[model samples]
Target chain A: MRIHVQNPAGTSAFSFTRAQWDAAVKRHPDMRDLEVTIDNSDDGWSAALPVADIVLTWVDIVGAKLRGCDLSHAAPRLKLLSCNSAGVDRLAPFDWLPRDIALLNNSGIHADKAGEFGLMALLMLHNNMPAHIRSQHAQRWAPMHATTLKGRTLVIVGLGAIGGGVARLAKMLGMTIVGVRNGSAPHEYCDEVVSVSDIHKTLVRAEDLVLACPLTKDTRNLLSRERIALLPRGARVINIGRGQLWDQDAVCDALDSGHLQYAFTDVAWSEPVEEGHRLWATPGLILTPHIAADDRDRYNDITLDILFENIRAHAAGRPLPNQIDPVRGY
Target chain B: MRIHVQNPAGTSAFSFTRAQWDAAVKRHPDMRDLEVTIDNSDDGWSAALPVADIVLTWVDIVGAKLRGCDLSHAAPRLKLLSCNSAGVDRLAPFDWLPRDIALLNNSGIHADKAGEFGLMALLMLHNNMPAHIRSQHAQRWAPMHATTLKGRTLVIVGLGAIGGGVARLAKMLGMTIVGVRNGSAPHEYCDEVVSVSDIHKTLVRAEDLVLACPLTKDTRNLLSRERIALLPRGARVINIGRGQLWDQDAVCDALDSGHLQYAFTDVAWSEPVEEGHRLWATPGLILTPHIAADDRDRYNDITLDILFENIRAHAAGRPLPNQIDPVRGY
Candidate 1:
């Protein structure tokens, strides 16, 4: 299979290093037969995309690359467009993707980085960092009280790879874990399990909350104003999922009204979140520019693992891991 | 034996609740033969400080309860003064403590809480929380890159209970651990163990540095300006040990000069670091109000365990655990 590497998002600075390229090519002997072509921002895609049997892409490049070039002329052998990200939302803007092409995300692999970021958000809020920052800037030597995770309740929405990673770390910190998701199978890290419909009950008891669920038509604005109100006052909220999964107004109001201690989001509806967006200055909101998962140090290695797995599976005509259901839009 | 409880810290606020007190007193049927007396801040110490055979105290209460009352008349039966804190530094003011009295510190018990706080401080700095705070107040949508613990080198200056906890968590986060201590015995959490004399060599390669070592005359000002200079530029320092262990001027200068990224300290030379102290206003210093080990929810429970063990051992003419060496001054 011929694979074309595309960096349409213009992150040439972070393109796969020579070692990463070597690792992927040498990962398995079978990969030796696969022809790979690399592309950069300076190079025009005059011929690469149209002839690629499989397009290896970045999360942010899908829409830009697709919009800038015509992919209808893609080689008939092009069966997949593999992404190097946990979430596939960045690919949504490219509506012209061929129906025959399977969309595979690097789901479980980047979970480590994403999950670590989620854990960071929890620690930041629990430590009352906002207050500390203010004190530091004002040169105030204040020893603010920090509430530890020991014996406190943590509620995780979504039982995916990311959520599982967060659960494991939270458990180590001595938190009691309550999980909410569609599946009912027992999750070892969770002390208690609840269905998606019962998230309200979970939120009421949650001192620290995490949202790692995929966004779909069924889950848009899952954390609505009323549902957010269901959470105990002073609860902390962290979003490692799509930004649209939370109602911005509800989150801002909660922080402003002091119903929520703080809200940290790694994803936003707008990539850079326009210059003066309300979330930027919201009292208890911390707007990080959507780089949590992408900032991972082992990002390329993890993405390569996913790519290798799917490649081997495809060769055997077996089911591909992390193949997204386009209609459901994960 | 008679046990007198003195809470001049008046953590009547933090004291055992009705149920907690009941549970402790009723913990063992053998306690029925023992006598226990409780004293609050309001209670006059006219007799409380004199007649107690075994005194159970909080670290903060030592100075407060000892200074105003005369201890020269302590009962002939007075045998032990057990503290519910890991450090007996607060007892420094009581130079006249009877040489015959065995002083016991709750050393390893709160290691869990203090270590967790140490881990918290690490996560905060590595996540670039300070920059995020700046962006939040400026209402800017800037996503700063943050370094992760994955594959980074961490040097632990002590390998005690608290250091061990921090090491375990750091390992889970993918850091390589280097330990320096007086003991040459291999520590499980450290990948490389070095003697006290090798600290400067360890500091040169450390990306993250931690001090969980005890402070004595030999260890004071351990992080002197020259030693701090040996650390790789931009190294982060965390002090969960006595405040005097670090040279305040050295740390402040390092942060201001951009040689160190940040320093987080739970202990200051003075509790409630005096207002306007240089440390209070140091650019990258976080002055936590000395509650790392003190806020532990298990404080009283751990204290009780020590008391019970000592009581049983003392009655049998056996040596008590956690007995402090007056010469070593732990």
Candidate 2:
């Protein structure tokens, strides 16, 4: 199978090199018989796309590279599209996605890092660290109280890879973990799992809320103003999914009204979160420029593992891992 | 036995009410026959201390009540001194403390809250949240990469109430937990435990160092300039135990030289952490006036539990739950 990697957004990005591929096949003997050709590049990658059966691209380069490159005319043989991000919300704007193509995301690999990010966000909010930081900047000595994590209820939305990791951490800290997802959770990290329909019920009991689901039509703005109101006043939220999933204005209003204690996000509407935005001034809204779960070497290692596993699964004609439920958006 | 209640701190601190004492006696039954006298006041508590067999006081008001009060002459029969604080450093100034006096601190009461504070400190340092907050204030969108918490090593310098809780939380977050104290740890929350003699060896392996032991001769300046230098460059430090354990100036220098990634302290030598202090301007230093555990309800709950247990143990002539080592401090 011919694989063309679209290193689109300038500089280098996550890719499966020929050497890495050979090592993978060597490890996974089932794929030893299949021949593989890789054309990884940034500049003339579209030229090699026509002969490719699979394309390793990124979620961030849709507008810059994917939009300009005509997929049907250039990559007629392409049967699969593997995204670089663990979450595929970056593919939302790509309306021309081929229906016949298989889509896979580099998930689970980033779960450990993403879970740590979620935990950090929760800790910062619960401990009143943001207010402490503000006081530190002014050199003012005003200390605020922080609630304990033990025995507190954490409602995790979307009990997937990242959510599972977060649940395990919270559980270990003596927190009562409840998960919210499309259906039942197959894992055992959380104390209980509730359906999306019962999310409002779960929100009332949640001292901390984590949004870890993927972005899709159904999940976009899933946490609406009404749902946020369901979370009793002063509840903390950490969103590691996508910015569009939150109604930013509603969140800002909740924070302003003190209805929400803190809303920390690693995902935002815009990547850089430019100046003159209301979000910058939103009280209790801790803005992070989306650099959670980083460590390039580790990131590359996890991504390579996922890539290798997906390739072996595809070659063996087995159901692919982390294959997004186009219907659920994760 | 005559029990005179010493309520010398002006208002109610963490004291058992007459009704509470009655209930405690009823609950224990063994202490029901003791003659309990009411001397709950600041003005004349010293006069009643002479006849007291046991004195219940607080850590915050030790000096105001204990300094001019002649304990040896007034309370020759004193068998136990119960303090309403997790650590007994507040009791260090009294050189006249009778050698026979069994001192007890309301330890393990504030562990959950203090542990949460420690977690917050680590998260803020690891995620670089202070810089993000600074950028938010400046309306800048500068994003920086963060190191993950998993697989990192954490050295908890005290495996007591607060330190053990912190170790448990850190371990749950996927960190390798090593503990350091005057001697061996009694419980098993950490991956390993070492003595103070082996602290330097442990410091070299610690990515994060937490000072959770009390202030004492051996522990004061425990993370001295020499020991601070022993830590790996860019190591993070969190002080929830006492501020004097760290050489603040040395920590500031470490932060200035980029030798320490972050230093967050809930406790300082001085409580309000006065203005014009170098710590206010120190790079990567996150300071908060010591309010790690400020839930009055929880405080009272934990204190009452300790009071009941200690009273029962004292009446039954059993060893106290949190009898501090006069030499090792806590």
Candidate 3:
């Protein structure tokens, strides 16, 4: 068996030394019988197609290009494609893949980091910290009365790994957690769980709404203008997931009108948003370049461990963990 | 049991509606409860002072005008003198006529309001919310990374009512609470408690330090230039107490040098701080006009209740609930 690994530049995993790689291989004795090819090139499509039994690819790679490549002429043995990401929207319309090939994702790996970002955003809005910082800089003692989250309601739009982590953290801070997911079943961390179809009705009860869902056909632009308006005045919104899940223009309008107290987004529709974007000027808006899941050391180690475990399971003819359901498009 | 309440406005308690005046009388059932004299005129002071069993006078009357007023002449009848404030610095130097006059304060009344303010200030510094709000107003997607308090250390100065409240709330949010007070007594909410003598040494461990001590001779300029330098870099300071507790120049310099991330202050050496003060333009400083304890409806009610409770205790010869020892000044 042989494995191929590909990742973006500056990722520390690319610098894993020979001794460390040897130790990792020793820990996974099954990999001793396998051949591994570490490919760090833009032309990974042509380079990795040959001799690779398993492929580990970065999230940014264009899935269509990988599928169109003539893999049978190169790496005919490829049986699995593992994504170093939680979402698989970019890999959509994936029906063209060989039927025997399996897809797995790095889903739970980013939970802690993303949940940390979401909690920070909520605290920022509730305390009106930004206004205080500006006043501090100006040496002005302009104190304002800030709201407390002690008895507030938090509505999590998804109950996946990241959202579950957020719910647990928020609950510890004395907040009431209300979760909305596609499934009808209630989550353990949420005080109330409603189907995604009742999201608008649930909005009225949420004091702070957090979006932590993947971008699927059913979830794209899920927070439409009408739904955004349904949120009570002074409600806050935090998005640590895909930016396309919300109607950005409507969010900006709500923030501008002071109807929504604040909104924070780590993921944007466009990377490196243009200078004149309306979101830049919206009142009570916090924007961060998509870095919600950024624990470099830990994330790299976790990604590698997940990949190694999946490979071992595959060789034993056992079920692969984190296997993506093609129908669900998770 | 005739009590005399002296306010600068010189309006008698009788000037209020019958219901309001009766409420005050009901709290002190032991009092003969004669009509409350206005005492606005200097002449009324001489007559009212002699016969009064209890005195609730304004701080202004106890200041420089002490030379002209003959307080000792009326001291024989006075059993209690309750100050309607947390600070008694002005009353400290005065030599009361007798040791029996109990000095009480409205301490616990302001804890919730002030603690809420400190929490808000800490959140502001950690989240960098104001910068985001400004960028949002400018319509620019200025992306920046923010710190979180989830795993940070919070150092609280003065583990009394206000500081204790802050510790309780921060502890609930998963923060490690370290406290400094006059004594080294163990505190229930604090993970570690240190004496004021060890504050400089403890500063190194604090990521967020809150000033909640009263302004006193010993604590004046406690956070001096030399001591401010001892704090961990990027540590934030939230002062909900007296401004004199911190060295303004040193704090400004730390913020300007980017060593101190932010400062939030509700109290200043001067009220309605004049324009052109250095603090007004200091980066990372939040200036609030000392309204931390200003929950309009709750404020008056809480303070009045404290006074009423003390008056009742005084009339029955019971120990006052919030008595302040003049020597310690808290």
Candidate 4:
């Protein structure tokens, strides 16, 4: 089988170096027997696509005009379009994807990274790290004591790979997890599982709220102004999912009004938040520029692992675990 | 039996309220049979200590003159002196205590709180939160990605109550715990246990270093300038122990030089950190005002639990579990 690996042009966070590829090959020796080609230029894609049976890429390769390449006529043998990202929300509407080629995402690869980040976010919010950080900026020596998170309730929305990661770590930390998802399926990590329709009841008792779902039509602005108000006073908020998962303004207002004690969000409504954005100076707000889940050093390794696993499954006529359901738009 | 509970004169972190005392009594029902008197004044101590069989205090009641009251001459029935703290280094030298009196400390109560805080600090350091906070102060949207804590080496000094607490949590987070305490006895949570004398060997491999030992003659300035330099480049330092346990100036210098990636210190050489202290403006440094372990909401209740547990042990023939070894100064 022939495989084509297309990296994004210029310097990107997910850009893989040649050394990384070599290291990954050493880790997954099965790649040695395959015909592989790697490039970043559009010309390279034009050349490699025609002979490629499998293609691995970051989502940027797919756009309205398919990066101005005619993949339908060029890549006849392509059986897999593997994306090196957990969320493929930006690449919705599978009309551009050839029906013959299956799309697989790098989802479960982020579990360990998300789990650690989620726990850290929860602990930071509980211990008032954001406020303490603000105090440090002003050279203030204020000590705000906090209780342990032993019995605190967490209402985590979306029990997918990312949310499940947070749930596992949070449960281990002695928190009572209330998972909110599309269906009321019982989860191993959550103490109680409630559907999205029953989120209000869980919100009323939520001491901590985590957003770790995909940015689907139903999930956008899920935590609106009213829902923010429903959370008990001093509740902490964490958004590791897409920023559109909650109302950013409502979060800021709740934090400003002291209804929410603190908020830690890795994502923003807009990438690279412009100068003078209110979020930059918002009190009790820790804005981490969308770097919560990706472990830069191991991201490519894990992505390659996913790709290899899917390739093996495809070869064996088994269902690919990371394959995206086109109808779900995940 | 008469139990005198002398609280600090003003509002203190560990000061127990009347409601708290009543709550403690409710939790430990055996206390109902005893005559318990709670007071916060010099006059109250003068009247109560003379006839008291046990004393519960926040370590302020014992001075050179024993709070200007003679405990040996008046309090002949005093059998147990329980301090509402884990470390009794400040009250070292057992000359003031009568030979018949056994000193008990609130040690294990801090495990849960310390575990949470320790895990938070490590995560913050690993994720470069100190630098992120600095960027947040400048309203910069710089994203620094980090690897997970799994398989990372943690050289934790002092595997006592606080350090042990940190170890259990760190171990759960997939870190390799190398505990450094007074003895070389292996601990359950630590992958390897080393004595204080062999700390230099561990420092070279330490990706993260934690100071959680007591401030005794042997431990004062334990993490000296040379010791700090022994750590690998970009190593993170967390001091949740006493202020005197590590060299603060060395930590600041290392942070400034970029030899250390970040440092999260809850204690300082002299705290309330004073106006114009260099630590206030140090880059890549997070200085919290020494509120690391104490869960203020449950501190008094836990202290009462310790007191009751000790009281029960004293009633029986068994030795008080929290009783201090005078030679150890903790």
Q: Report the lDDT tens digits of candidate 1 across residue range A147-239.
A: 467888999988888888789888878889998988567798999989988777778888888988888777789999998999999998998
lDDT of 4 at A200: 93
| TM value for model 2 | 0.89
List candidate 3 stretches off by more than 4 Å: A1-5, A10-57, A62-67, A70-80, A96-101, A129-143, A291-298, A301-321, B1-103, B106-153, B172-175, B233-238, B261-275, B284-321
Q: Which lDDT tens digits does candidate 4 get at residues B123-230?
A: 988887887777777889888899899999999999888999999999988999999988899999999999889988999999999999888878999999999999
Off by over 4 Å in 1: A9-11, A42-44, A67-72, A93-95, A144-147, A274-278, B9-12, B16-19, B64-72, B93-95, B274-284
> Which digits, one per residue and each the tens of the lDDT, describe model 4 over residues A1-330?
998888888777777667777877788897777777888888988899889999888876765325445667878888998888888888876666767889888988789888899999999988888878878777889999998989999989989888999999889889999999888989999999999999998999999999999887778899999999999998899999998888999999998999998999999889898879988889999888888899977998888877888988998999998888878887
Candidate 3 lDDT, B1-330, residue by residue in tens: 666666655453212233444665576564335556545556666677787776665556655444345556655676666666666765665455246667667777666656665665676676664455445545566555453466789999998778887887677667899899988998888999999998878999889999888877898898889988999988888888888898888899998998998887777777778778876666677676776654433544455567778877766788788787767776
Note the Cα lDDT for every prediction shown.
Answer: 0.76, 0.76, 0.73, 0.87
TM-score of chain A of 2: 0.88
- When summed lDDT is taken over every stretch of 10 residues in candidate 1 chain A, the lowest stretch is A67-76
lDDT assessment of candidate 2? 0.76
Candidate No. with top TM-score:
4
* DockQ each: 0.48, 0.59, 0.27, 0.81
Itemize residue pairs with steric clashes in candidate 4.
none
Q: Give chain B TM-scores in order.
A: 0.88, 0.88, 0.86, 0.95
After TM-score superposition, the amount by which residue B192's alpha carbon in candidate 1 deviates from its true location, in angstroms, is 3.5
* Model 3 chain B weakest lDDT span, ten residues long: B12-21
TM-score of 4: 0.96
